[model samples]
Target chain A: MPEKSKSSPQAIGYLYGRRTRIFSLLGLGIILILIIGIATSIGSVPIPLGTTAGILVDKLPFVEITPTWQDATATIVLDIRLPRIILAGLVGAALAVAGATYQGLFRNPLADPYLIGVAQGASLGAVIGFLLPAAWNLSGMGVIPVFAFIGAIAATVVVYFLSRVGKTLPVTTLILAGVALSALLGSIVSYLVISSGSKLHSIVFWMMGSFSGSAWSEVFLVLPYIAVGIAVIVIFARLLNVMQLDEEQAQQLGVNVEKFKIILLAAATLITAASVAFVGTIGFVGIIIPHAVRLIWGADHRFLLPLSILTGAIFMILTDLVSRTVLAPTEIPIGVITAICGAPFFLYLLRRRKRAIF
Target chain B: MIELEMRNVTLGYDHHPVMEDVTFKASPGEVVGLIGPNGSGKSTIIRALSHLIRRKSGVITVGGRDIEKIKRQELACLLGVVPQLPLLPSTFTAFEIVLMGRNPHLGLFEAESRRDFEITRQAMARTGTGKLANRHVNELSGGEIQCLLIARVLVQETQAILLDEPTANLDIGRQEDILDLIKNLCRENNLTVLAAIHDLNLAAQYCDRLILINDKHIHAQGTPAEVITNANISRVYGAENCVFTHPVNGLPTVLLSALKKKEIGRNTISQR
Candidate 1:
């Protein structure tokens, strides 16, 4: 067959073309890799950028490089900084994708991973874990994340049941119920904090979120949840787009709205719980990164969801890097860094484009 | 080709019955217009037929199969709908909205392929909405949005179509154009169509048959001449004589007169 004419619309993949979408996914993947390598080298000792790349490439299969770096530098790159960098990226990707899922599922631009009380519940669980007697704290058990995970799931289930009117899971009711549960859980956490004696400072620091002493175990623990959650979320991307037309139209378009919503909610909540369980609640990423991706790459969730994964991972790593280095040993919270950097940058992007992002 | 039938269906919210034991059927290649007063279950019936809501007491079948037994995805391939007050995301482009009609055909892992794009573009062209493809949904006028909704439904390529007040926001010209397009498509494709139209005259002109709803029941069902008579209009709408034959086509037409003091019957006047 003859090549299609370029003047007509069919010559490309409708709007935004396949080129832009592919370029976005691939380009951001490369940037994320670069950011990870650079971030691993930037902390405390400040290793050289080339040495960081060499160290990273050396770890790949069958690649052997002559050791030019000191033993301490390798320890910093391989053992300490690499794990933290990987953890930050995984958490970031999880939170961002989860946020995008909530926004699409609720059809509200302001929605985030924490919108459904996942943060409050996780915090409560972490606080309880923090206050528990030392006898219960076993080595390598990682009690806090487990407690946080259970708390998050429990809170979501309560909210889901509360929001149902007959058989339908109304979005408005879901949001309202989430808000109500969040307030209740937040108050309980605060009470637990006040009643506790020596654990208060550690509790507050953990709640603020950080990758200060992240371990490879933490990364491994979080990988399965985030990976599965994101895979499920991407599969529902097209359905999420149709849902923007409201549930009534979605049903008419052939979606089982009730079943679909539950699946999405479960996936979003899972990744969010995984992310919050380890690093605390990183606020700005889930809410803003998706919007940023949408403003530049249209609102098709197929591209929007995947692009957010890359954008979010890079953003989280960079924010974690700044949090540790900008304060230099004092260690500003990662949550603080994310809000400070994300809001202004998102606003700048919004101002540059006159079109509506949501 | 499909035949849509609602057999003794009761539709409404919980503990409420908007319409009771309603029975109707539209055959293949038929345009069935549902005319009703406000709150008389037009939209409710449309929802029931499309499987958006379950019928309380009866069966709704499409193409001789129970709709309740059909999977939602398969039902979508068989039926398309143009909602009255559709909520289109403002950030989405018209082309993207239209392309969503192909959702039923796409698999979980699949993206929009070349053929889906071609069909969507053709649907937009057919509905005269090709010019608005790149424009955001919020930027378009209501009539334009309605036409885009039509284009979206057209992309479904279903064997049956449902429309709830499909021309409510449109001007007279666009109203006639959309109805004519719907009628032509119904006949040409041998597809079953059911539309809830508020305009009695427009419904008469375009619909192959009419089902007039009054007081939560299908009060009249027949051809335009049989159902659109002066007596039927006065009894169902509780209005004075307003039905007349169209000069051009001799189909039924309605021209309303302002309520005048003399037009009120002496009994209602005395009671007032």
Candidate 2:
């Protein structure tokens, strides 16, 4: 039997205390709003912080603030900066939550949204769409994201089936299968990218990832997919918690393991595909944001999902701001910024913690 | 109260058959011990009963309803299972793991209520796991994890419980405490329990009936005194001289002795 620690029960009560969770969630909410406002104010044409708030309030339904800011400032805040920030936030939230879900599903802390080749598949699809005849272009920004979503889902389905031996999904086998497939698909994408003569610059830029050309149209296009996917995941958060146990134990506890796995995989993949399709592939946000949240709060998905959503959004908005302003006129790829900032912090977390969290 | 019955259940993995034409019945308020050699499909039988795996043929029913026909949530309410080696997430606290037993009773969007917390706390208290509620499952010892699993099943509040070698990692005193607690719950709540146990003495002491499996079939089954005999033990387990009746209860008991050189050599040759 385990040795009884007199302090453990009290420690547990504190760790899972309801009030602490509520307060932390509330704090994150405030931080997200602050980051959005601050990020909106930091672009090339620096809009005053108060004017950024005023412009946002003016757009609200009933509340109309007198236009104190110039039309150019308003355009910068509302049209260009606001859409980019919101898209970045949405994609970040989507990737982080998807990452958390994948980590839980695979029972591996290293599992990320891109672990199963979603990014590579989406990249291939987007490249194909770009290489298609110009006559097929229906809108200014068209076909790429739709095709990307399809390719991501198709790749995930293929990986899932290939990894299954009978009814069991061994984690090691799944990761290996995903890695192998990702390498294959990535080569195909590289081959396609090389053959595209004049479109090399655009395709490479897309692959490197950025929120540069983000528009309200792109946001509207991805909204429904991300919204529905997140809603489904949030609804099944507790089931995800139960799924932390082995498949057999979860099944015995009345979770329809196979069905639940399918539903969660689909939802997570949908959001991830949508997030990556427009912004290319932002790496690290999905993996790091969730881990950062787990470090602060506990691993309860009920809290983890929502907290990850907020933290990811905040992190992405700040990273995007850094990408744009750090080197003026020439913007660094958002992926590079995320990697540079995230990798060192992740290493620090690894060095600081002694026990395995997962 | 629920009565569990399996009729000619054939269980296996893939196409390879392990246990064939197995049949058993345990009425409400009875504890049935499934005792067998390792690899004899004791855990497979429990898995089949829990619907973790499908039986190749025949029907397994609880309270006269086919387990296959029942919905997952409904079946979970009817029977709770304690797997021999459960893989739990290292980060989850014992309280959170125990609280998951309320999953079947909850709807898709429902959160645990105060009553659910009360029941889970009561289960932890009953299993003497209240002190360890804050600890991570990965940090816990094997015996503590076993007790935590039992607490989880108790919170499940099923009419029947199935345990797969539930006391394998526990000390002698802890083993008795857990078995006695299960036995008391069986008698008081009219719960049917089917446990796969390796320890024959504990089986004879706690189980109302015992099923001895040998060579993929039920070799002998009855009250402990009837099923555990010198001839049966010698044939099924190859322990001829070790089988003896208990002094106080008159039930069969196994006493181990150092094997003679010839006997050890013969057993080693046969194993090879």
Give the candidate number with the greatest DockQ. Answer: 2
Which 10 residues in a row give candidate 1 chain A its minimum summed lDDT? A1-10
- Which portions of model 1 miss their true places by more than 4 Å? A1-7, A10-17, B259-272
Give the lDDT of residue B194 in candidate 2.
97
lDDT of 2 by residue, B1-272 (tens): 88999999898988999899999999999999999899888999999999988989989998899988998888999999999967789888899999999999999978888788777777888888988777888989999999999999999999999999999999999999999999999999999999999999999989999999988899999999898887888788887667778899887788866462235667765677
Report how far off residue B36 is in candidate 2 (Å).
0.8
TM-score per model over all chains: 0.96, 0.95
Model 1 CAPRI rating: acceptable
- With a 3 Å backbone cut-off (N, CA, C), the pairs that clash in candidate 1 are none
TM-score of chain B alone in model 1: 0.95
Which digits, one per residue and each the tens of the lDDT, describe model 2 over residues A123-215? 889899899998998577788877777778778888989999887676677778889899999999999999999998988888878999799
